[model samples]
Target chain A: MKLLSGEIISNEKCGKGLYKIEVFSPYICRNANAGQFVNVKCSPDGILDPLLRRPFSIYNVEKEYNVFSILYLEKGKGTKFLSDLKKGSNLNFAGPLGSSISIGDRSKNFLLVGGGIGIAPLYFLARTLIQKGKNIFFAAGFKDNNFIEWSGELTRLGINYRIFTEDGSWGDEGLATDFVKENIKKYKNYKIYCCGPRDMLISMQDILAGKKISVTALLEERMACGVGVCRGCAVKIKDGNGSFVYKTVCKDGPAFDLMEVIFD
Target chain B: MIEGSGINLSVNLGRIKLKNPVVTCSGTFSSGLEYSEFYDVSILGAVTTKSFSFVSRAGNPPPRIWETTCGMLNSIGLQNEGIDFFIKNHLPKIKSLGAKIILSIFGDDPGEFKKIAREVKKVESSLLAVELNLSCPNVKEGGIAFSSMPAEVEKITEAVCKILEIPLIVKLSPNSDSIIESAIRAKCGGAEAVSIINSIVGTAIDIDTFKPRLGNVTGGMSGPAIKPIALAKVYFLAKADILPIIGMGGIYDWRDAVEFLVAGASAVGVGTANFVDYEAGKKIIEGIRNYLSKKGINDINKIIGKAIC
Candidate 1:
């Protein structure tokens, strides 16, 4: 991975408390994949406030223009500083980090599940899968109607998708877990790829347990060095012998088999 | 005119000699597992592994780290697969890289420290030195308490030093009552060198949640914010002439490393800076060589205490 300076091409408010920032970095955009992320240095030089770089999933990549975008919410100090960045400012970023989601056997049906902002990476994955001429089923859940901004893009891509909202003011009412529990058995041979809050992932895992389906989750944790040197962002994984070993989310995965995760 | 190629960056820490003075701090470099993928691990002075105990530690839960202004607070609780795993799985790989290895050992008491040190000595070969980490502020039992007391520091250092054939480097804590006194005690206990200023104890709170930001409630703070405090400590230790100080705190680049060397450090450790820039060690090495050549200083040893009057 290379540490390159990215100039902001545009930063726009895409949804409620969500932003889509596109940056110009040929080095990162050329090598970036679907599930990989970028560690963005939000603060300016000589400013130590908000000292760590925030890791964001690669939302989209336009290799022709050498531009990549990241979808983020105003969660804390780092993103709050990032939200204030303008069109012409320079941002130092290190990336194409973390392991990418493995697409095994393109002939099988690909079922993608995402919750809230976790859909950022899944959008990239769906685009790649569609281009590969694979059968894709996408389902996303948001808190309310204000978060359904990506539906338009999904439609333009001619992707068959379902949207759910907790407030019942949007599409289907209830969690994404409810959607999976209702229609998961319809596909014969499939692999489930999911990303979202831990609660949502766990709920879906509970419904899929003891089944023949294979599920890979794009996990999330508070990370410092996205390069795996700092030993931050560790997640416990159960080995084959029913014991748990600590694997870092930055290196060993931002993706892991759902069966291996020992979510405490 | 021997301007670029004649610059020598080698350094001597007690009986141990290093190719350069840039070392990765303990608990940051991950025993050369992750960093070797980015750059050659042997380019630095030495690679200090993360602190390991006798038994495996699960460490703290999620939210173990929090970002502050110019620094970070972490209570990782010394997570490791224990000394046994390091010897079996990690040592051969680290040894193969041909980098000087300084094994950092931590424990809950003097006896535990001696036990782990003895075990490490028996299995590992080509070890440059053993760093006894007496100043980890995250754990409650054997960390800050031992380093805070001069008598306990002397006891632990002497206990660990008696068992090993290699030189012992005692890592000091900044939160102690008197850092210089602690260093002097380590020297009396036969420590070859001292690594100053392990992360200082600090805390942060979430304004909206009205609760602690870190899962451990408190953690040791490191980065640029702590550089000034670390520099002063290294200066005082060097002024006292207690022992050769391996100074570190908020070292980001070559200028920061040079500041530590001039403040009386025989070597410098790069910790939190690795999180910011993964290739910081390589960049700093080049920066130091360029600075030395430009200043017409042939040997790095001449600049060890150049700033001290």
Candidate 2:
């Protein structure tokens, strides 16, 4: 991975508490892959207030223009500071960090599941699989219709997708995991890839396990160095010897087999 | 005028000689594998591996770290894969890097410390020294307990010193009532050097949630915020003339490293700075060379304790 300065091409509020920031950084975009993330230095140079860089998944990449976008929620001080930046502001970021999802066997059908902001990386994966002429299905959940983002892009790509919202204001009045359970038998032959809140992922894992369907889930944790060095962002995974070992989320995976993970 | 390449950055920490005075502090650098992507690990004086014990540790749970004013607090609980894993998986790669290796060992008591040290001696040959991590304030046992008391510090040092062939450097905690006394006791116990000022015990509370920010409730604080306190400790240790000091705490740049040197550190370690910049150790090495060349001081040893005498 390389540390490069990315100039903001545009920053817009895409939905409630959501932002889509597009940056022009050839160094990162050229090498970035699906499921990888960038560690952004949110605070300005010489200011160490929010000392650590925040990690955001690569939402999309436009290689022709050497541009990439990150989808994030204005959750804390670091992200709030990020939202205030105008067009053409240069931000320092390190990427394309963490292990990418295994595309594996393009001939196999793919089913993608995303929840809230977790949809960020899944969008990139969907785009990639669609371009390869692979049959893809997307199932996403937001708090409500007001929080939904990226459905239009999915339509433009001509990819089949389903949306769910908790308050019945959007398609399907239920949680994402409920939707996945209802549709599991229909997509029995497809390989499943999921990204969402920890509870959603875990519950979905239980549903998939009972059906004997394998899945890959993208995990998230508070991290210091988005590299393996600090041993921050560790998640327990079953070793080959049947014992659990702490694998760093930033390195060993941001994407791991749903079966191997031991969530606390 | 001294040539740029001719500046002597090598340092002698009693029995061990380092190519330079810039060592990656334990727990931050991670055995040189992670930072190797940025720069060669051998360029640093030595790479101190994360401290380990006889048994593998799972470490603390989530929210292990939290950001503070100018630094960060971490209670990683000395998370490691134990000594056997180090010998089997990590040591070969670290040895291949060609940097002087200093194994940081942590144990609850004197016998455990000796056991770990004995195992380390049989497997590794290129070790510059074994730094006894007696001052980690985060762990529930065997960390600050040994360093806080003078007699325990002496006992552990002497116990490990007896079994090891290489030099023993006792790392002392700044949280103690008398750091000087601790250093003196380490010297009396046959430690060749002492690396002072491990992170101070600290805590942070989330104003919104009205709860502790870290899962461990408290952790050891490090980064630019602790540099001044580290310098003062180094200055005090220098005044006592106990042993060669390997000083560190919140070192961010070359100027910070120099401050420790002038305060009387035979060598300086870069810790939290590694997180801010992966190549911080290399940059600090260059910065020290430039500072020495500009001042027309050809030898780095000449600058040690210059602030006092």
Candidate 3:
């Protein structure tokens, strides 16, 4: 992966404690994929306030304009600094990390399950899969109307989607996992991809436990080196040897089979 | 003459000499493979492999690392694939990268350190030196860090130094009041040089979870936050006129590296910067070269101990 700097096109506050930072980088626009991520230097050049780079999933890519964007929640010092970035300021980051996911030519039906800000990568995945003439259905759960603008963006792309919120202020008054549980039989032949909070992903894993459907999870963890070096961001995975081995989310996967992943 | 041009950046650390005074800290760079993807590993003086043991270890549980204000804490517990796997598989690959490798070894006891040292002696031709890691604060195998006890430090050093032909550098910690004493003991035990400051023992608590942030409860703290403390220890050893020192802690840029050199460090180790920028060593090397040349200095050795000398 290349460490390059791009001019910040925009850093907009999309919702409560949420930001969408778009940057102009042809390298990322050309090299990055749907399921990959970029580790951003949250602080200014030479400033190490937040020592490690923050990992953000690729929310969108506009190859035509040589730009890419990441959806972030301003939970810490890093994203707060990112949210304050002015237009034309240089943003440094290491890119196209982890294994990139793509769609199978024969697989026509695809379902995306996302929870809260976890919808970032799935949006990029859905946008790419739709271009391949695949039938896509998105079911996402949120805490509030934080994703109302995101739903508009999805509709603009003509993607079929369903939304769930705990407050019933959006689409349905329930959790996304509940929706998937009731409709699991209908999505029997559809390939499933999910990204969300740990409990939500775990709930989905339990819902599809005995089912034959293929499911891949997009995982996020606090990381130092976004490459394979540090051995810091580890997740338990079935190693085919009965027990499990700690696989780094930065390298081995930000994406893995829901069945192979063992959640504590 | 143009400033920063044609200046020598090399230094001799006791019995061994480095083309430059920059080395990656043990447990930070991990055999220099992942970082090699970003920049040439050979650019730095040497790449210190993550500490290895006689047997492979999976290490402590997650979350193994947590970022603080200007530093981070890690309890990796020296998770490595054993010395044999490194020598047979990793050494040749890193050697091919043209980077000088310093094998870092740690053990639960003196015997374990000697076993790893014996293995290093077998592959001495491939390594520049052997660094005995006596400062790891994560594991509790010995009920305490070897660095905290000067006697155990000497005992371990004496046993491992007996089996090694290459220069030995003991990596000491600043966890106790007897760090200089431990360094003296290391020097007495046959070590040619000392790597000042392994990470300090520190812990962080999550306010939300109301528990310790690290799964290991406490981990070794490293990065820019620890530089001042590291510089003092380096100066302490340098002032004591013991073994040559490889000073490291919180060194992020060339200015910090220069500070360590001025404080009497024969060499500087870049630890946490490699996490923020994979090519931090390469940039620091270039920066040092520029600093030396711009200041009208012709050799890096001329600046060693410049402040206190």
Top candidate by TM-score: 3
TM-score of each: 0.90, 0.93, 0.96
Candidate 2 C-alpha error for residue B174, in Å: 2.0
Off by over 4 Å in 3: B1-4, B142-144
Q: lDDT tens digits, residues B1-309, model 2?
A: 124578888898888888899998999988888888889988889998889888788888767778888899888888898888988898888888787789888997888887898788797576888989999998878788877688999999888888887998888999878788888899888999999889999999989999898888998999889999999999988988889999999888899999999999999999988887778899999999999989998899999999975
Ranking by DockQ: 3, 2, 1
Give me candidate 2's TM-score against the actual structure.
0.93
Task: Report the C-alpha lDDT of model 1 over B104-179, residue by residue, as the tens digit.
Answer: 9999988898889879879646688889899999998889997778888899889887788888899999997778
- lDDT string, candidate 3, A163-195, tens digits: 999999999999999999999999999999999
TM-score of model 1 vs. true structure: 0.90
* lDDT, residue A151, candidate 1: 73
Query: Model 3: which docking level applies?
Result: medium
**Residue pairs with backbone overlap in model 3:** B4-B293, B4-B294, B223-B250, B224-B250
Best by lDDT: 3
Q: Candidate 2 on A136-222: residue-level lDDT in tens?
A: 888888788855555777677788888889898989888888987887888888888899998898888788876767688888887
How much DockQ does model 1 earn?
0.60
Query: Which residue pairs in model 2 clash with each other?
Result: B223-B250
